[model samples]
Target chain A: MKFKTLVRPLLVATAAVGATAVAQPAAKPSPEGVATAAQNVIIDRALLTAFKALPSRFEDAKNPITAEKVELGRMLYFDTRLSKNQDLSCNSCHDLNTFGVDNKPTSTGHKKQLGGRNSPTVYNAGGHTTQFWDGRAANLEEQAKGPILNPVEMAMPSADHVVATIKSIPGYVTAFQKSFPGEADPVTYDNLAKAIGAFERQLVTPSRFDKFLGGDDKALTQVEKAGLKTFLDQGCQTCHYGPALGGSLQKLGLVVPYQAKDQGRFDLTKKESDRMVFRVPTLRNVAKTGPWFHDGSITELQTAVKLMAQHQLGKQLTDTDAKQILAFLDSLTGELPKGYIAKPKLPPSGPKTPKPDPT
Target chain B: MKFKTLVRPLLVATAAVGATAVAQPAAKPSPEGVATAAQNVIIDRALLTAFKALPSRFEDAKNPITAEKVELGRMLYFDTRLSKNQDLSCNSCHDLNTFGVDNKPTSTGHKKQLGGRNSPTVYNAGGHTTQFWDGRAANLEEQAKGPILNPVEMAMPSADHVVATIKSIPGYVTAFQKSFPGEADPVTYDNLAKAIGAFERQLVTPSRFDKFLGGDDKALTQVEKAGLKTFLDQGCQTCHYGPALGGSLQKLGLVVPYQAKDQGRFDLTKKESDRMVFRVPTLRNVAKTGPWFHDGSITELQTAVKLMAQHQLGKQLTDTDAKQILAFLDSLTGELPKGYIAKPKLPPSGPKTPKPDPT
Candidate 1:
């Protein structure tokens, strides 16, 4: 069946409904968009039909992501003093603006030191099975701790220091008690990471890709559909499958040697076979995060796609193929989190030389 | 008066109310918090007092910036394919995710050519009297058209091409007709610019700074308040005044000679006097847009501050002064536009190839 032909009927139906709404509004017109009696009848019938089609609330057991936790996480993420040097926070790299990743080749960390890996986007990270390039962490909780203690990242001296910092803040102490009851130390470093992890788990971005996946056939354009087909045909889906589309762990070089001289998982496992293995990063928001890869060598999406195809697939992709894939990738950008991107609150005093953590 | 002393009484009042509520709820406790009833009473009293204070709704007009023309202008500002190559959109550079600007040192344009200047944010562009680095456009409407036809920016062949492109799209045709009726060509390039301008006018980002401005003494922390004082004392407010701080036009190097080779306003006007003259961009949302300035040579806010102090003010600013100014600047970041950051619905087939304008 022709795509245009199928769309024509839907367009006609919409036009008919619009016409009826306009015509009926002339008689006994109401304020606002509230319909008149005749219009209401039609509207009610349509609403009823839609309601019937909707799945039961229990069947769709998606719990609401709380606003309080999001608010807390946002505050924690932006608090620069969380770092050992009192310079970095989660937001230093994963900015709410700029597509949730700092667009640097590699992110700067403690004392302006560059990290080895490109900062992946925090967007839709909730949907991924594991976090980070190495995939050492089982969840965002583990991932959060890795950055805080990592000498190259936030570079916090110890978890005890983090706990001490939180304990010192009266407001944070009160908040911690509220968030976690019956705990010896609710404001401990572990709890802080856990709270942040809870917030990160709620960052599931609903995009056009998800809309297409949810049976909205018309959600994507022709070029994007073509790219999807090409991606599948090229065997890119062999590893990058499921909702996250390659968040699951996989061998870095499926068909070719993993270049860049980085032993991805070997450092963690000390196993020869794990040398080139790495977590398959979710393609959910790949377009927004540039300077791709663990080393952040690739700048453009096209360059990344070409390199991935050549190195992993052992196949050359045309420019047109890369463009199509980019289009599809662009469709993955979802809405920004509501009320998350806000002006930073100024501290009570000017940049104070804090008395160093006694701990 | 000490802040703690003032708050102590309020805390005592709150505790009394909280105690009463807790006691009453013990037998048949409400699931709501102990403070809920007290909060409700306080809100009710406050509303009554406010109404008594200002009897007329007109006196207490809380209606924010709402101009139809401005809304229309914003729509045009966001629309892609305004360029001759039909590749670049307003969002290509001034993305919502990046608080407005694309956060690149300089954004790429049509045919993947690099633009000389970094894209400034449109967050509080409405507050500006003149627009752009050179202050060439008198208002946003004029600014909206400049980029559409700029060879280095969108690179649209001509205004005629833009008009024709809008006329061809059925959705645009209907929208233009509705927005501007009884016109020879409602979908003209001018109207397109006007629509975008209208939308831009509505993009007012309310922030904690506004609350402080509105006489909320406690709205800002002591540090931010001190920063504000330092900013005013440093004579930064001489040019960067009014609601849209620094929207007014000023010579770029008022206190010093032009350091950069780029001819600023001289390129636009061909007048020697106009050399290095540029619009003082609004400080609103400055935190989100990095790699700041017309040339985007500066990356950090502190660096920009230090340079501004050295050149514009002709005084070496202390590190303390720089930090305070940065704190003040951070407070200028505001809320994102409602519903503007939503993930867009892709065309059903997928991402589409660029097509020629039907008109």
Candidate 2:
């Protein structure tokens, strides 16, 4: 439908989550096109139901967020001293300034070791039901622990090694004490993970799509609204429709076979049905987090979208359809929090701090 | 001569360069003290002539500083695209967040290659007579271009490769144009070095020493003043007395023969006079920019000081004296400009941006 040609009409905005709403035309098209206009209304209503405005925060009942914890987390996030080699920090892989992802196909880790899976954007990741592609870790806190101890990642010798390393840096010890007040010893490995998780929870990114969903009709342009209609019609909303666009588990290469060495969830669970299944990463700041997919094989976003349509939906999209979807996705690029992400003045290492084991 | 017993007196602050200075008693103890005080007067005059307060800026006649160029230089400084592997940058070695060092004995580069020398602190490097430990590069601009192409550093194949890689990122081209206004094309490799140099030239770190040198009598504590006295009396100021503390070139082992595989400046100039000679790095922020020395062989700052006294001055400093000197060096750790060193919002990659060639 030529969306801009149809004048916007006064309609009651739907406030309830998942309730359907549509952009009503000023006047119904002529009698011959009346049926088509009604169908367009149904597609718009589905889009209203499928999408939602971003929430202000993502909360966890088990791991509560606190200002002190978040502040410490910020320092820990930038502290390369956390790594065995004292080179790679959390920011080395999930850079806040660059839409969370390192903008690499695969991130280089301790001793420049490369991991197989691509790093997904940490923006809006707090809302994900599970962390990491394989859903191995149930929450951000659990997910945070894996990398530092991984030989190919931060590469601390062991949990004990990490504890000793943190305890040696006097500034970190003080920060840990302040973050987990009343604890006998707060500089434990678990507390470190919790602090990092708290910081990650605050990394929410909201975009214009959020404003559009909140009933500010002028938030998205006519082309973006048209792109919305196309998205719903093509069933892209089936796997990717929510506050974060996609935060559920889905099978890779559902309809068409994917060619890759990575076994995906099958490698973790050893279950037949779980083959190639992976977490559908949130689409917030998706335009910036590329090359796309679990393997990070795709470089071009349009090519990625086209491939998804063919492999996942068993359908083909026109070049025009791809362009509109891309324009819509561009609206997902949110403003980076200037103050929150400002680089902190990392405290100097104490005399007893261990030197880097760079070998 | 116990420093705590020596009271400060009403006297004109010396304001000369490269003169001598010695801590003197407010009142003469006796006839012997009178002769000592006279000698102290001569030393104090020399100290006034030996050093000057840090200048506000280091202006370059060849390449001037500008707002646009600095802004662009900041992005380039943080951009890892400068490396052949797209995993390293100027920041990788000389991290601004950590007192302009990786805090590693030596930095890890492409494919986890380690350099033969320690990465020097970039802070106050602009004021140095020459860049690089061996004084191979004449200035910051010349030194900026050496790393990316070095086999052990960033490991880019050639200058052409770096130019082509930078050109691929569309945002950098626009930035280059703005930074080098009136030029038909400014994205050349030479301009790349210039922009980075401009950013680095602004990395001057002035500490409490500057305030003391500026005639603020109470700027340094009595102990710090005593430490200064000890530093001067022990003849440590012969090579390390200046705005940057130690920016002049000096023989690495003047009084004692040193053993090392590296030939220092002899490897660069192949002259006998150049043997064991190296550029004396700035002592500003030296407490943080460790492990000390060209080989990064010394991890503790005081040990480095003690070794210098033993080898260069042919003197064994008492534990008390070394402790006092360390306290004074601690005063050299300056405040990091939080806003100026904050991470910048880098421009997004263009469609033409090349993929990483990890091999």
| lDDT of each residue in A39-63, candidate 2, tens digit only | 2221223125345677776788888
Worst window of 10 by summed lDDT in candidate 1 chain A: A42-51
The residue-by-residue lDDT of candidate 2 on B1-359, one tens digit each, is 11211121211111110122111221112233212322222112223324557776677988899988888888888888788788888988999999999988888988998898899988888877667888777678889899988978888889988888888888888989999999988989899999988888888777887787777766777666656755664546555655677665665644333446676766776544355666777788888998888888887787788767654443445556677678778878987766667778888777877666576
Model 1's alpha-carbon lDDT is 0.58
Report how closely model 2 matches the true complex, as a DockQ value: 0.00
lDDT per residue, candidate 1, B149-172, as tens digits? 877778877887777666666666
Docking class of 1: incorrect
Please compute the TM-score of chain B alone for each predicted structure, in the order given.
0.76, 0.86
Contacts from the true interface found in each model, as a fraction, amount to 0.00, 0.00
